[model samples]
Target chain A: MREKLIEFRNVSFRYGEEEPWVLKDVSFDIYKNEWVAIIGHNGSGKSTIAKLMNGLLFPQEGEIYINGQVVNQDTIWDIRKEVGMVFQNPDNQFVGTTVQDDVAFGMENRGIPRDEMIRRIDESLTAVGMQDYRLTEPHRLSGGQKQRVAIASVLAISPQVLILDEATAMLDPKGRLEIMSTVSNVQDRNELSLITITHDLREVVQAERVIVMNEGVIWDEAKPREIFAKKDRLREIGLDVPFIATLADELNKSGLRISNEPLNHEELLEDLWTLHSKM
Target chain B: MDITFKNVDYIYQENSPFAHKAIENLSFHIPSGSFVAVIGHTGSGKSTLIQHLNGLIRPSNGEVHIGDFRLTNDDKPKNMKELRSRVGVVFQYPEHQLFEETVAKDIAFGPENFGVYKRDIEKRIKEIIPAVGLSEELLERSPFELSGGQMRRVAIAGVLAIKPEILVLDEPTAGLDPRGQKEIMEMFYDLHQKENLTTVLVTHSMEDAVKYADHVIILNKGTKYMEGKPEEVLTQQEALNKVQLDVPEMIEFLYAFEKRFGLPIPFKRQSVKQLADEIQHAMKEAGSHE
Candidate 1:
């Protein structure tokens, strides 16, 4: 059986008594080494969940468990050690002058040894494919390179869970792809659980499971294919289906045989070729 | 207002050791009331080119003509404020520029600065609120109290309050969600048509360029890499890839289909439904030949 790394039980949160609840009775479980994507429109409470996981915010009712321990004021410090977060706006999160120095910031905060910090900084930089830019300053690098450095800093601490809250929203298309591929490569060699909060459906294709949020509630939870199958419903909820799925649906409507849940271009083309040969 | 750039060059910190040319010999003409998309990667001179449109920066070499205002290194229009009032630039993350206590005041800030009459500013505010998809109820509320998307709309409404003849958008939908992105783009397109405004959009999304732009200019390393109609320029996948860009997904799909079926499907800015119909027709024709 798989282990449950994180759990939220009947959690509800709000900033104050008069403020409306941002998360209402939200419950979910994340397993070890799983990649889950949480998607919602702006102000949909998706970012609230990321903060609640790392104890940045506390629930007004019910409880949250991280690594089989309840999150409380006393345990918050220990819980933070297990959960590392990368937020939106690459410029706001960067602290160090150089690439290597940025990766060492988190480790230095925990009073890690000099030799150990050196080893970890090197390992994390190489993992994100940014080893050659160790001496480069933050302003000199492109948006994509800065994000990679942010990812490496998060990895240097070696947290069990990594939550990226709209991390790629500020980046261009090329920068978005670079961060996505870097996260995939890091996951292949480590047992890290990734929670990506985004509104971009293209990034959702990489997740093992998807959780859709609407109006401060958990609207749906399923695999990527199952979630994308309902194209009109997604559109109604202020989300968009991927381009491949939209094209596949158009083909199906036009008396062509294609799967309604094609995740990528190659799959849709393969299905079309099969149908074409039989015709 | 038509925009023309002739042999323009913009250099940062000119005549110093740190001097670097941001735009080199860039020349393009955007006819009055036409929508143009400037496509490029980061640091590719897209921002520098747009700054010239509103007379924000004088070109180091050559000349720029926007309507009757001509800007060169040696001379600038005496009425620079009037030129600015006619060109509206909705920059990336415009919400950050909001500072007024109420939405109504924030929207009125621009027109007030341009010496617009008080009653005219109020009239523009009323017409702009609903046009940018905002309710009248929020006009009295604090701009900081609104959501990110709402703040962006309010900022855009401020730009429109001046009633500019030309609109420049610098990735106006950068941090918005999918639905918000569509709504904002559609709103801009609607305004572009109704007002007969010349639109210049600097964006990285090839999809947006293909959807809304009649002409596209691709920039690479401070130079014009290519310029033509969207269908003619964007279909060159190899050339775009050289600049660290890709064709839109529709064109990419068509290319893959051509490779798999040994058939060519010309892209004429077709919608998905139209493209599907063409694909269906192509498949039947191939089967009959076999």
Candidate 2:
């Protein structure tokens, strides 16, 4: 049987006892090697969902099952090893001055041997295409490079899944693309499950599955095309549709009938060409 | 307006071992009352260029002049407080800069610092708060308690209380959800129209540059790469790509149409709706023969 990597069985959480529940009746199952995008607008409890997966925030109402081990005070420390987290703001996340040192830190905490740690650090850094900059100071790197290092740090630990908490939001367009491209490569090479928590629709265009959150609950969940089909519903929740999807919708509204549900430039071009030739 | 750089050069920590050049021999200008957009790759020195306009950073070897207040390699005072007041600068993540107990106090900080009287500051806050879509009732609450969108407005209000003739925003919509981004951009457009505000915008969104900017200046590797009206800058897509800046996909699509059909269409148009309308008209006109 393909293992149930992470299962959130009707989980709920809040910042404080008096506060309204940030996550209510949330439930989903993430499988091995699936790249899932948790889509939401600001204050939608998407970040809280991620925190719960990594054991940073324990669910208040229900339980989180990681590899069939329930996440609780007793098993959280063990669960953290199975789910690695890469937070936003790489500047704040760097615990080490140099890139190599940062990548080695998590392994060091795990009591891995010095030589094995060194080998894995190199492997992870190279996997993220940041081996050349391993000796460079983390602070001196750009946002994208810093984020790659952050990913490398997590990858060194070799968790079954990596949670990126809006890790690409703050970067410039070029930087964002670089980070996403690197992440895509790593996901393919390592077959690591990815849970990207973000509002940027562009970042999640090719995700295997998408779970859209609204006001602490799953508003809708579907495959990328199926989910993006509800363009108006998505926009109503203060989220922009993927650019190509947006273009297709606008074209449809204007009577320029396009057939394909394109989420990107190349696909949009292909669809438009078919329509133009048919005309 | 007309912010010509004129061989402007700026160095960070000059004469020290850690000395680095930020902007080197750069030159450009934003005409008065015209919205100019600045785009550049990271470390291309656009931030330094913006700071130069307000005298926040002085050139190490060249000079920069704003209307009358000038900055040179060797001249001008240490404090350009007057210059700063007239040129309202809204920073990226301006919400993070908010530190007042109340929104009104936060907005009042800039004017009060510049010796604007209490009554005038109150009047200024009242005038602009609504413009930013924040009501007066929300003014007494802690600035931190407001939503990110509202907090950004408070920060903008802080800058607007100074009654600047020119507004320079460095990625005002960065880190905002698309809805929040649209809200802020529309608010800026409104402010620019209602007050005749001369706006210099630094943005990563080529769509925003084409949508709002009358003129566009592009920098690459700390030097001027291109400068023209939006139509002029966007027409040369290859140069923009070379500098790692994205052109609006719609604009690219329109250009492809002209290339394929040899259609005498204006490809510089940015609006997708406008392009679609033009395409239908052309098609229907041609199909009349069929």
Candidate 3:
């Protein structure tokens, strides 16, 4: 059986009494070594889940358990050690002048010994493919490079669950791909429970499972392919699907007999090739 | 107004130790009332180029011409107020600049500063609120009270209240969701058409560049890398890839399909249904010939 890494039970949260609940009775469990994408439109409470997980905010009505430990203030510190979150703005998260210093900042805060911190800084930067840029200043790096450094800093803590809260939202397409591939590499090398909170469908395509958030509630939970197949409903909730999925849906509507719902370009091409061969 | 940059260069902190050449020898002509999209990776000088469109920053080496107005290396335009009224710029994350008590006051800020009549400012606010797809009920609320997407619309409305002949947008839809992005882009395109404005869009989205722009310009490392019609410039995938750029998804799909099937499928900005029809026809013809 897969181990449960984090669980939110009967969670309901709001910023203040005047404000409406942002997340209402939301319950979900993240399993060990699995990738889950939390997707929603803005103001949809997708990001609240990330904050709740790391103990930045406690739910008003419910409890969040990290590895079976209740996430109250006393246990919050321990929960943070296991859950390292990379937030949306790359510029805001950067706390060091140089790349190496930035990677070491987290460990320094935790009072890790200098020798071990130095070792981890090297290992984590190498994992993100940013080893060559170790001495570069934060301002000199690209948005994608800075985000990777943020990932490296998180990895320095050796967390079991790494939460990327719209980490690639501010990056260009090339940068987005870099973060996605870097995350894939880190997951390959470590036993990580990765939760990516984003509205980006391209990122969602890579996730093993998707959690759809709409209007402060969990709308649906399914595999990425299953989520993409609900293209119209996804759009109705103010989200989009990848190009291939949309194209497949369009072709199917136009009387093209596609046997399966293709998720990406390669699969779509293969389906087209099969149709062409039969013709 | 038509814009021309003749061998322009801009150096930030030119004489100091922190001196950096932000743009170099950048020369381009934007004809009056044309929609031009400028695209490049971060630090590729896209921001520096747009600053020249208005008189935000004067060129360090050469001349920038906005119709009859000229901005040269040694001289600042005396009529900067007049030039600014004609060119409205919506900067990235424009909502952050909003500080007014009400949306009406915020949108009216631009025109009021330009000496528009008080009555006329109110009229412009009424007209612009709808143009940006925000209901008039939002006009009384503080901009800070609005959602992120709504605040962005309010900021765009502020720029539009000036009724600029030249609309220069620096990624107006940067942080919006998909529906919000589509809505904002469509609003800008409609404004571009109805007002006959010369629009300059600096963005990171190749998809938006292909869908809306008549012409596209690519900047690389403080220099003009390429400029042409959108279809022509975007289909050159290898060249774009060299600069760490991507073609629009439609064009990319076609390119990949051609390579995989050994069929020469020309790239076109068409709906998926149309593409499907063309692919089916191609398959029929190829099968019959075989």
Candidate 4:
């Protein structure tokens, strides 16, 4: 779809009228059904950017357009309805004791019919791979499970754009994979656009596009391959290059006659096989 | 059970409607002089488990023992004032636990509380300042004014000041940049090795645990689910997946190699590149065999 789900036009935001702008003049766009990752070190204004999308923190200057509607006082609630947020810190975000109860809290606020709410809750939990623990108390579940429940809560609202702000930071490695897979599937199955703000570079491997932010500005933007090309620069921004990226860089340095095109293991293997067969 | 939990149970807000069981029938141990990493997805009762180690809470049904100190599941029976000196527990966001003005004073808090000599407290402050990778100049500065990573080191140094035999750090590296994460863990590793300290590291990063942990402990639903060396625990992908744990990404690649390429790569290779090199060599040897 050519439709732009969200657009920021020189968006600058501040916490208070007199306070310094938390986000300097910034401009970016999220197309419908696209999975875009916003990455930067802490205090690079990543969280502030995520807050802007949901209208949790409004812009002090410039403008943000969500679903073709300007994000402002008159339309903030509607914009939020279209762009739900899942924040970091599992312990702080939990509103209910039991997993089932926590997932239901969102629907309850919306005044969904009791029966429909029950069905939606089940569907959301299953979407995040957390259906088995619906009856368990959320506080008793592992960090990863709690995060899944948090995602389910956001999904239960059935918004068009899902913003996950470092959602996997508290989760262990396996849990991180589960959440990543769930997000990938959510975008595919539900056709919801995603704006994931995370410092975990491992996550960017699967993103459709990557946006690196620095001092509240888009420092770089490209597809995974192109973005990962500047490995040294990425590290300079306090970001990690992929293991594959490092390997490729090393091969280039070591005078290995490997093709420059292979970006992943599968591609590298095919390249090596072709080289060997030709020899 | 080096630190065993036998039919151990903990119910928060007990005797009221809000009552909840944090952990159930949990049993595990921390053998002396071992670096044990406890990997749980967030609420696997990790904090609840560590609290018992220092007699912070009296278990409702089970008993907790740290060396000679024995604790029944019921009743608060602990000479915890003394236990605090033996076992140092660094909670998450330990910086928030800081109160004193200067870094050195904050570190000296623990040793001072234990009624150690003033000279000994001063001695610990000076020695551990560098161990945590902080300069002596930082000793006089206000901890609140320091950067987050530096503040973290100060907090860790504070914990290190008392020089507890058994040190437990819960997600000591959460919210840090990659370099900060690596640095703090390296400090922990250094301290763990240089001193014969019994260390328990609670973390979500499999890479950190697999790299530094001598032993790995997995807690599931407030119970001691599994305990073994890091290598032994990680090889069981099925069990790890059940509790939502993962081997490092590099290790996962090796596991995939064995399943897909029919490669007979052994596990002794240390780093990712080492494993990749081994794979390269094995593939070459296989080609020669063909």
The lDDT leader among the candidates is: 1
Per-residue lDDT over B12-94 for candidate 2, one digit per residue giving the tens place of the 0 to 100 score: 99899999988888877666788989988889998988888788778898778787778887898555888888899998888
Over the stretch B1-290, how does candidate 4's per-residue lDDT look in tens digits? 25656678999999999988888987776678888998886567888888888888878887877777787855554576787788888888888887888888888888888899999889888788888888999888989878678888888887888888899999999888776777788888888889988998988877777888888888887877888888888667878777667666566656665665577666652765565456556766666777
* Candidate 1 TM-score, C-alpha based: 0.98
List where candidate 1 sits over 4 angstroms from the true fold. Answer: none
Q: What DockQ, on C-alphas, does every prediction get? A: 0.80, 0.50, 0.70, 0.27
Kindly report the fnat of each predicted structure, to 2 decimals.
0.73, 0.42, 0.66, 0.28
- Tell me the spans in candidate 2 whose CA falls farther than 4 Å from its real position: B77-79, B256-265, B268-270, B281-290
lDDT of 1 by residue, B98-175 (tens): 999999999999999999999999998989999999999999999999999999999999999999999999999998
The C-alpha RMSD in Å for every predicted model, in order, reads 1.1, 2.0, 1.3, 4.4
Model 4 stretches astray by more than 4 angstroms:
A13-22, A96-149, A173-178, A247-279, B1-32, B40-45, B58-79, B99-108, B116-123, B126-151, B219-226, B238-244, B288-290
Best by DockQ: 1
lDDT tens digits, residue span A1-279, model 4: 478999999998877877667688899888989889988876678889888887778887899999889988888878877888887788888998789899999889878899998999999999989988888986567677788898899899899999998888777676777788888888889969998888787687678999888766789988878888898888888777776666656544544456664556676555545644444
Task: State the lDDT of candidate 3 residue by residue for B86-205, as single tens digits.
Answer: 999999999999999999999999999999999999988888888899999988999999999999999989999999999999988877888889999999999999999999999988
For candidate 4, give the docking quality class from DockQ: acceptable
Q: What is the DockQ of the complex in model 4?
A: 0.27
**Clashing residue pairs in candidate 4, if any?**
A142-B41, A142-B42, A143-B41, A143-B42, A143-B43, B3-B28, B3-B29, B5-B27, B59-B73
Which residue pairs clash within candidate 1?
none
The C-alpha TM-scores of every prediction are 0.98, 0.95, 0.98, 0.81
In model 3, chain B matches the true chain B with a TM-score of 0.98
Per-prediction TM-score, chain B alone:
0.99, 0.94, 0.98, 0.94
What stretches of model 3 exceed 4 Å from their correct place?
A: none
